[model samples]
Target: MKEDAVDGDPFTTRDVGVAYHAYSASGDVTAPVVYAGSGNPSDYDWLTKQGIDVKGKIVLVRYSVPYSYRGFKALAAEQRGAAGILIYSDPAEDGFKKGRTYPDGPWGPESHIQRGGIGYDFRVPGDPLTPGWASVPGAPRIKAADAASLPKIMSAPLSWRDARPILEALKGPDAPATWQGGLPITYRVGAGPATVHMRVQMDDKVRPIWTVTGRLTGTQSPDQLVIVGNHRDAWVYGGVDPSSGTASLMELARSLGALAKRGTRPKRTIVFASWDAEEFTLTSSTEWGEQHARDLAEHAVAYLNVDSSTSGPDFKASAVPSLNRLVVQSARDILDIEEGTPEMLSNRLGGGSDYTVFLNFLGVPIVDMSFSGPYGVYHSMYDNHRWMQKFGDPGFVRHTAMTRLWGVMALRLANGDVVPLDYRASADRFREFIKEAVQTARLADLPALRPLKAAADRFAIAADRAGLRIETLLAGDPPDPAAAALIDRVLIGTERAFLDSAGIPGRPWYRHLIYAPKATYAPEVLPGVTEALEARDRKQIALQVARLAAALDRAAAILDGSR
Candidate 1:
């Protein structure tokens, strides 16, 4: 390495490194390294003003500050004609800046690296070659080059320690004040002073993924299903990721078996799934969902997904709006060791986990949860049993509490006469979604929005009537089986009613009109409308609005028993 290569920035090269990020193009290149701040569009806009271009350069970007995923950063760089991207974690985002360092506290050490896939799973998850179908043996497939979710540029992960020299080598304008990282050097947006060699080789191959599914057939309605799921795969050992959730699920399953042995069974079937290859591309669950699409559409009552069940003690959850009350009840039922109340339920379901296919693609009601906190060693080797025992979950009391909550929630869904789905929350959320969509688009005169609002209002009315009927049944003697079945049938169709076979515009595989990731970690509200707004096309926006209104009216009709 030349002295001028780093501009005398002192950094010790270490042996610690991660696998080339998934989907990163295999490459060997030596090119000038450019700092693109966080690689967000705004940063690119600033670079344009300084007459800096990233084409054919390897762009250095920090892990999200305002919180965009690494895949988004890579996509942004590739779109700018950058040959490759290196995403490093700054202490300010995930290390010493947050709290004490590892060994003393839960934050990451200087050498920690985050390993993740860089696929545009937000566009379409599962096997990229088989977009709308299962990846079973001999299944129909498409060329990898044509896969929408595949990335075309090289990408890798870096720790701040490894990145300091390159950043210091930059001889350009100081970065925006907000772009300054925790490293001591003056942060600069550089397209010069640093030239480096980078090589990545990956065995990009198609393989089979397995999803292990088990069922406890119901004593009564065996067709109506309550599903519980957790990913079995991990980036590393994944102690605090799926391991915690898996252990809890195993205990829950064991308890369910014990109950069944004692002749006690749920009124509706309970299905437990251990999904494989979630860390790869959300593979197994997505494929399974595609394989059993018709059965799931007809039978799946609700889905409960647990990922990293107890990283700390802060309980957080995301759910479809209709499941709001049920989730709230479960949260209230669980007695956390720390007595921390669950955070407000976020209705947006992100595509980062196994729940994506069920909630977004299949239009099944879903709730995803975790007991998360600031351990900071996420996706690294340090995210292991020692960390979980010492910091993530001392004594594993939180883990036990999670199992209790999960079992209770699943039992409630399975034992309830009418599946316990309350649509008032859905109505309220739809009303709010329309207002937000209108405000987001800044189209006060959008005609489709008016019809959308009308549908929401009617849905609310129907929801209120159904709520009254449910209350009456619960207060009096046990309702007749025929009456309960009628209401349950209608409620089952509520989520399915939101599906549009055309999907959110171009991404037809994501059939749910109501929810999708929309190209980020967290799910966005009114994904179709949001997609149109992102495209800045008024015609598409109007078309999306009309479609959404129709879906809402259809849901309203189901709730009103007029479907």
Candidate 2:
């Protein structure tokens, strides 16, 4: 890899570096560059509308979009006949436009490059060679060349400073206003005079990675499980990414250990997991989940994930609706370290972390939380303890707060007689999703969504009645273990109802009907409906819609104790 000189001097070790996609095949090529804004699906469509052909070119895209969406961009570029892909972080989103540059503030500097894996994770996330199964000792393996999720072309991350010369040399029409970034040069969609060479050399071989697990057995319901996890790997130092979460997990384990020493063990089994290779492709956790699928499906109650636990002070969370009430209650109980007030957790759903396997594949109710502020030095060399102490959490208060929140939530889930899942809230959330899906589908002239709306309404009624019955039972004297057990069965089975054993179209690994990660602007419920509609496959749209309705019906029947 080569980069332009800066300040009449070539790049030193501090300024010159590259981050490549995992499993990127070794290659050497030189081609003209094309600027595709954000490299989203719509952005590609925009490039088409502007009559710019990226075929046989080196594509340049900004890293403003979600990490889950980055691979889609690379795949899209490959399909369009691109020779290679270069990704960079624009100052508009994470640098000077947001705040001061790094060395002065928390934002990224021109030399701070964001590096990450470029696997097409929305299809399947794990070791590329071992899909749909655990990568265990002597496991059945496939050839690395046959792994469909790996990138078909070379790809790397570039610092914006290194990218400026190539971008400025391009000759093309001015980009749409929104396509313009915070760079000083005039942005253009390029097929350029800026030809450049690219190469990615990687050793494709299986290696050993460890997932550290610590278990505390329950006193009464030893079979019921509550798991907490954070990945241990990083692109570089990872101070604000996994390391922050890793520190919080360590603190949580210590706290829980102290509590256990005082004879306060949880009522249900609690597991603490520090996963490895998550930055590469969610390898360790996914493999572990696959290895223990049967046990987890039967015994696991919930999974709480803390990735990048604190970059700031605001409390943010993403979870399945059944866990919403528990998360809110937990947040309200913990005071924010910076604000000195009860934290208010905000909910959204999108996948880019270790929660994928537990939530999407296993149907285990999961929640991921972080106390995030302005974190711009993501995946860069600058994300070290020095940066963390100076800009991220000076007093480590946010880390302590995250530990408390995680420990308290795990304790509640493990010890509560009546599992704190709220199906009524799930129903309400489903209704919202159905309404939005219907609105979006109608705009696209899709009529297959009617049945989904009807099913959501039916499910809502059943969920409400079930919620009332559970509340009444909880209020009764000497909580009936049998009744509580029955409710627990229903709660656990509800998430499974959304699973389609055959999996989503094109992406068989993600079977959940409610949530699946995609390259969309916002998370969609019944994701297959939108995907099918996008493909203009009326038959597939109808099929997915009917299956979603059937799943909802199944959930309702289980909650009503009819199944």
Candidate 3:
């Protein structure tokens, strides 16, 4: 390493090393550097437009986008013959631009480097070798080298402080306006005067990870399952990410345990899970879900997940629309500790948590909630209890509130005679998604969107009619056991109808048609349709649109009690 004229250290420290999926071989090679902003697919497109060839260069990208996108960037770079990759967090996204630096405020300081996996979570999100199966003690595994989601090129995280010299030394065309960061120097798309030497090494071994599961059997309906889970592992202190959620989970367990001791229990069985290794692509949860796939699919009512429980005062929830009503009802029942009043939980939808397996893979309805406020210290040592006390939850009241809300929601689902699923809401949400997808597809001039639009309309009508029947049933006297069981089965089966046994095009592990991560590393409503359109693959577009339409039609039939 050469000493730069810069005052501070020009190399990332060993303490905050790079993340998973980084190539695990050591070799020294120096090459010219190129600045690739955010490292999103569009950013690569921009580089191509600028006539910049990253081939034989070591690309410098920002850690502003999702981890999966980082992997996409690496794959793109490798395809273009790039030698290596270095990722840094720009102040515009996580540093002083958000607020005062760490030690002064919650934002990251100059040397704060965000470490995370570059694994292709959109393709599959468990142990790489296991893929679609659980990584159990005797589970058959594939060779590590043959894993489809692993990166081929070396990658590392560089603190902005360490990146200053390299960025300043770059010689190329001025970067586009959107490519500029909060750094003081002018951003550039370089094939540079600056060169970087990169290396990476990792241990290839299979290790045991424990998933702590505790169950309380229901006296009346022991077969019905209500599961609530939060991951217990972290890369660092994890105060705002998993620790906060972990604490809330413990509190909920304590409260529930007390009720059970007093002989007051939920009508449906409850399972409390503290999953391990979620940070490495949702490992424990996915494995456990897969291992228990049969029983879960038959009995599980819903999965409620909480990660990064409270980072701020605003209540937010992401869920399949069938569970939206329960989320709303729960939020309305609990007092927002910050505001001293009840407020509606903001609706959000996407992936990046423990709920992925249950909702996207197993087709179980799920609701994930959090209270987020300026979170800049993610995946860093700075995310400690001290930081959480100062910026996340000052009095810990929000944690209690979250626990109470979770309990209420779980209890409501467990004890209700009728499963509280709202097909009308699901239909309405699907309609909205169709409109949005159609508009975006049209803008992209995609010819395959017509089928999706037509299918969504048909599903909407079916869903409305089904919803009316459910309402009529609920409004009358308590249904007989047979009728109640039929309604419950239909409600549970609706999500399952969306699953395609063959799974998505390239990622066989993710089977759901309604929800799956797109290539951009964000969750899409009709993932099959959106991903095919994004790839500009005419054949896939037609194929996925038909699959998505069929899934919706199946869901409608289930909800209408035809299946």
| Best candidate according to lDDT | 1
**In model 3, where is the ten-residue run with the lowest total lDDT?**
1-10
Cα lDDT tens digits, model 2, 245-314, are: 9999998898898889999999999999999999877999999999999999998999999988888877
Candidate 3 clashes between residue pairs 3 or more apart in a chain or in different chains: none
Using TM-score as the measure, name the better of candidate 1 and candidate 3: 1
List, residue by residue over 63-154, the lDDT tens digit for candidate 1.
Answer: 87445778888889999999889988889988899898665688877777777888988888988899999888899999988999999999
Cα lDDT of candidate 3 equals 0.78
- Collision count of model 2: 1
Which candidate wins on TM-score?
A: 1
Give one digit per residue, the lDDT tens place, for model 3 in 160-248. 88888988999788988988999999988888889877766666567899999998888777888999999989866688889999999
Instruction: Tell me the lDDT of candidate 1.
Output: 0.82
Q: TM-score for every candidate vs. truth?
A: 0.94, 0.93, 0.90
| Candidate 1 ranges with C-alpha deviation above 4 Å | 1-18, 65-67, 336-342
Q: For model 1, what is the error of residue 518's alpha carbon versus the real structure, in angstroms, after optimal superposition?
A: 2.8
**lDDT: the better of candidates 1 and 3:** 1
Specify the poorest-scoring 10-residue window by lDDT in model 2.
4-13
TM-score, structure 1 vs. true: 0.94
